[model samples]
Target: MEAGEHQAVQLCLESGALISTQQHDLSTPVHLACAQGAMDIVRLMFSRQPDQRGASMNATDKEGRTVILLAAARGAWKTVTALLRLDADLSVKDNLRRNLLHHIVLSGGLLDDFHGEINERLKDFGDLLNERDIQGCTAMHYASRNGQLKTIESLLHFGAIVNLKNNENQSPLHFAARYGRYNTVRHLLESKKGHLIINEMDGEGKTPLHIASQNGHTRVVHLLLVKGALLHRDHKGRTPLHYAVTNGFTHTMEQLLAVHSHLLDQSDRDGNTALHLAAMHNKANTASLLLSLSCKISHNEQDFTPIDYALHYKHSEVAMVMVTHPSRSEEVMSCRTKRYTCLVEGLTAVMPEVMMVKHSFQALQNTEGVGDIVPETDQPLPVMNIMVRYGREELLSHPLCVKYLETKWNSYGMYFHMLNLAVYTVFLSFLTTNAVQLMAEKTDRENFTQVTSAQLASAFVYPSTRAKYFLDIMNVLEWTLYISAGLMAAGHLSTAVVDRSNQYIMAALAVFLAWFNYLLYLQRFNRIGLYVVMFLEILSTLLKVMFVFSVLIIAFGLSFHILLAKIDMNVKTPVFDPFTGNVTMRSMNMSDKGFHNPVISLVRVGTMMLGELDFLGTYLRPMRALESSAWYQIVAATWFLVVFIVLMPILLMNLLIGLAVGDIETVRRNAQLKRLTMQVELHTDLERKLPRRILTMVDKTEVYVYPNQKGSSSYVSVPDTKHVFRVHSSYVLRD
Candidate 1:
């Protein structure tokens, strides 16, 4: 048995047996029953020991807390009513010297389903309202700490002192402001009896404003200022503005500045203004705002002028504005020679190749545009006539041209153009060796067959019939390749110029170019020819990636690098002799640096392989990979048909709806919690005044006390074992 679970005399009667008499170590049955709000047990126990009631009611527990004080602390309002009905002492103090009202205020009072029942309970015990604990903290102190705004208002209405200071010389308003109870502060300010805004200082000599600023409570600062709380300097001679800026309370600074701009120029004991602090900490926006307000700078401050501070710390943007001021232009000009020396030193830091590529690309983009060319004639001209009119009369001696002209014009003319050029050079080297083999070849042989394909494939006699046929095919292919290549090159050139204004358009064009190159590669069927096409495709893709990547790198890196170089120039050595500078530069070894990461190398290699795959796959359709054979053809016919036919858009629409619904639920939960908090504050403010009202009704002895119990309950009792056995045996005999 625990110390407080002793067998009371009243428990023997309830159990229908006389047990051994045992005394509780700290408290009797009445104390335990009242503290936990066990009302039925208290009533039964008190009825049996009517004479023991008064002594049990006044008994203190091991912790020196009275039963009523404990009940109030645990919010056992029903048990409190039972004890008070038996005339329990309400004036008793606990070990900490806190009274019943103080405990009630701390527990946020009893939880009640009905507000009327709560009002009745407070109306019965209102005389204990003015009682202070051992620490000189009243009921109002606990209410303020727990953010019980309604209870705080009630306490003030009951004549509880609102400005009363505790052991720390801090009042209720101080507690309210410190904990960010804005509504509670507003309530207290509105209460005529409550001090509008207590300027009382704590042990550290910090006023409420100092605490508010240090804690980043912008609303509290604003409230205090509205209620006329002095923004007074403390023992350290620092005002609220100094604290707000020093602690980086940007919102608080804005609030304070809205009413007081003179504080912007105010300096601390170190003689540094707010701008100086903002600059030192690299707070660019804050520094700019302060400078715009015309904050005065201390000229005598050592090595810490705003401009000097910015330059030393490498804030070139801020430093530029400060140094270029009309009043400081002379100083800036006097430092020009030094600036030039710094500029030369800065230029030495950049890589030379990077500079060259940047300048070359810029020059190419600045040239004028020319329109496309249209062919002048549709009919094929004779080779001799073309050679004579073009002023190249050497065609008669050219055997390839003479043979091409003798062969009647056919579709092979296109092939002859390319083959003739190759043959003329070959014939010039071996004039007498191949005349018979060259003239015996046939030009028109559709699906030409041979005993050994390699013999015919390897037979390369230029100006021969087979050679002319192959040359004709190449000439047609070359014209197509040139046309596609020109379009792609022109698109990229336009993108480079337009990218300066619109990045998204350039990105789209880059993607289109990748797909276009893939299509071009697919038209070439032979392996060697495929390799040549793929190489060109990879080159084009790499150029696009490099173009975009280089633009981004330069856009971000150049800004930072320029700012750093400018700052270094302004702060470092003023000037150096050109001869000495060149000698010093030559003494240092600066080359032999490159990107050494394996991952970057692997990524580059992987991109090239993917580009090759893209080129090859463009021609060969992977029909086996599709679910249905028709899918392959459908996809080949129209690219976007696969997605639209598969209901992808409907799935995306459902996903978006789910996300929007979840966001709405989150907003609703936040609003509910806020409402609950406000209601709790309002309830507390109402409960505090209940005590004083009860004191006014002291003359009426028929005080009606209604207890409100808010938690759930369960009943348990011991069963009779012997009676249960008798009942079971009688039923078995009857059966």
Candidate 2:
């Protein structure tokens, strides 16, 4: 391993004891000498044998590292010079396809005093100074990437191009910026001829500024910015500020923002600003910084705002910051936004045992005596509806409640009443016309049903007609629309069939309106009458189930009627003639009429299921003579047994009972909510009939403060509608 021991190896080689020694990796004696910077041992190995010199000098190790390449890489100046003098080819490369110059450059800071001589020797090859490896990186790239300032200067002095691009189209400046080499980046930018283009872009259109900003290289970012690196968008339309904010480089972000304040609102290809990126990544401090800069929170192409992203990613802290952002707090409390917030917040399930009742907050009296007495109609406020309903009474009187109460009707709400009125008037007129048509039809009932002239004249002449008309008001309207549309369709397909669904819809509308009219009058006792509505809902479900099961009954009736029809019918049965071996038949008079008609069969099956029929008399005795055949009578009896005993009595009856009992509690618990929902719907429909201008006069402003919380609130005052307040409280509004 030492330079002095080569003489012993020479003596062994001369005596023909051995030619050479090599390790498993194929590293020869010359390779070890060159790797260890033993220039004397390398000379001895070359001179100790004549024919071995060529193989020893040019031999590639397992990794394809030649002696001279290793010598140059290890800064073995004498060994490298000796190998070169002995005709070592500088063109030979390692497995990495790096030539001697590439290796020399890769040897960062290792080549100290011999750097000049090595550089001079490698520079003499001319093109080797700029030779690119397999990845198309020149020696200068390696020097720049490894922070070899002196080597980089030497290479550049030897005519290395400062802006030479690699396979990724990245210049040395990109490598320097990415690795955070502040001195190298400065030197590259301050090249004597200004050869380095400060704004040069890579294949991804990213400049050094973007790279440095992304990597949080503060000093390098400053150097690039001071060198007039223009802010340019990459392939993703992201600028350096976008990179800084996305990567959470606070210092770099501040510097970029300070220099380019206009980028505060710049959006990427996704329409996401730096603030949006910060929020999505849960960079709270960065988001706060951007919020402080008054960055506008705009929606992306997907209609997602920065706050939406924050909530979607479950970044609760970031979402809170965005939702409570000072600039948008008032906007968040606007009518449209507040309505959505309240609806969503109200629906979140809290305690399971809480009864289905609306909840309200009880505001404590403030010093200014501004608190309302929390009237029955005006509990805490609609904003506290969810908190009280879910038993989060602590938050019921929070400041957010005041903010929610500040929400007023949007400008569109001003015209909502007018639109509703127009719709209501149009439908009301249709209903009236339908009623008249129905009355006329009834007066002309001779067309549809037999009627005496005396009765018709009485209908035309007396007040009894009004009583009849009022009695059949809903039915008359529905039938009028139905028959009129049908008659019109019969006259011409295009006449009324074109909007047949519309006609049915109108008929249904009339029916519901009649029902709702009763509900409106019963609003005085809606709490008591809501039970009726819940019952009707349950009854409707039962009816739907009966409708479905009725088909099964019809199916079984038809199938079994046809099946049992031949059970005891008078028909000829085939038999064999014993003498001639030919077919013959015998006729029997059978009189089993139990399943003679499908309707009658259904009746029998129904009676049997109710346990009201004597099985022996009704079913067995009727088919008594057929029992001699055994199989037919047995199958028929078994069919009857399964249907009456198993299917009808046990399976279907229990299933119906279970269905009804399962949802009874659900229906009861949801009764009040459903009633409130229906009442709100009806009131909303009626409210839409008011004039737009009148609605504008009515509580268009959002905020209303009581006498107690007057100075504590920060909402614009709605002076007109302040006297009366409304709470969606279950106890006050319903009970």
- Top lDDT model: 2
TM-score of each: 0.41, 0.45
Model 2 bad stretches (over 4 Å): 1-11, 15-22, 75-78, 85-87, 109-124, 192-196, 324-735
Q: Can you list the residue pairs that collide in candidate 2?
A: 358-730, 369-708, 370-707, 370-708, 371-708, 417-688, 421-689
lDDT for model 1, please: 0.48
Q: Write the per-residue lDDT of candidate 2 for residues 494-560, one digit (tens) a residue.
A: 3244344454454455445534543433322324455666666676677888787776567656655
lDDT of each: 0.48, 0.60
List candidate 1 segments past 4 Å from native.
1-28, 110-136, 193-197, 268-735
Listed per candidate, the RMSD to the true structure in angstroms reads 38.1, 24.4
lDDT digits (tens) for residues 372-480 of candidate 1: 1112232123223333345453433232332232221222322433354344333222221221222333221211122112112222332223234445543344334
